[model samples]
Target: MTSATRIATLVAALGAAVALGGAAHAAQGEGVSEVSVSGHLPTQVTVPLAGKDRTVVRHEVRLAAGFVCRNAVTNRDLEFSDLNWCSQRSRVRAMRRYDGMVARGMLTAEAPVIVLSAR
Candidate 1:
């Protein structure tokens, strides 16, 4: 094959590999645990990522009815919206009722806007 053809093929393959790698990361990314943040929520959270691979600081949170978490860094109040209520949600209750903002994901917002779902 010509050198130009070979180079083009290599570039295409490299691009494909990079795309697939990103897709895998998206698939492997940590999912939001079925939980909510307590009232007067936290402004920051220290999330342990990838099987204790590393820790990340997250800000901005979504507090549901029964969230039992807090950020050791910033003490920001969480305003919750909507969330999935499960049968095993015996721990979540009122008093901790937040703004009910319908959301999911980490107790903080260092990452993208993610919401949790049972399905």
Candidate 2:
């Protein structure tokens, strides 16, 4: 009820707000719509992202040799005969991409985005 107490409370509230905003901003730096999806993988794989303010739509498909994608940049899927085994660097980059994506609105749920599901 005192003037001093009110001022102190105001200052504390402002600091807390600043801290939260900073944390949220730091979490989402870039608007990563989808993962670059480099490297290699057996079998067929396709990742689809729903529409959002960030981007309309995105589809990254990696199918078997015979499988094919009628379209690459659109709703259509894609297939590659040979896998690109670049290096662990690609994996790291993909992981970063996944993190950035989760930070952004691309991924809403709190789950493992980059799942290295190998058989």
CA lDDT of 85 in candidate 2?
Answer: 36
Q: After superposition, how far is residue 105 of candidate 2 from its true place, in Å?
A: 52
Best by TM-score: 1
Q: lDDT of all predictions, in order shown?
A: 0.35, 0.43
**Candidate 2: deviation at residue 57, Å?**
36
Top lDDT: which candidate number?
2
Stretches off by above 4 angstroms in model 2 are 30-119
Model 1 segments beyond 4 Å from truth? 30-119
Compose the digit string of candidate 2's lDDT tens values, residues 7-70: 9999999999999999999889777577687443342233333333222221122221112222
Q: How many clashes in each structure?
A: 11, 0
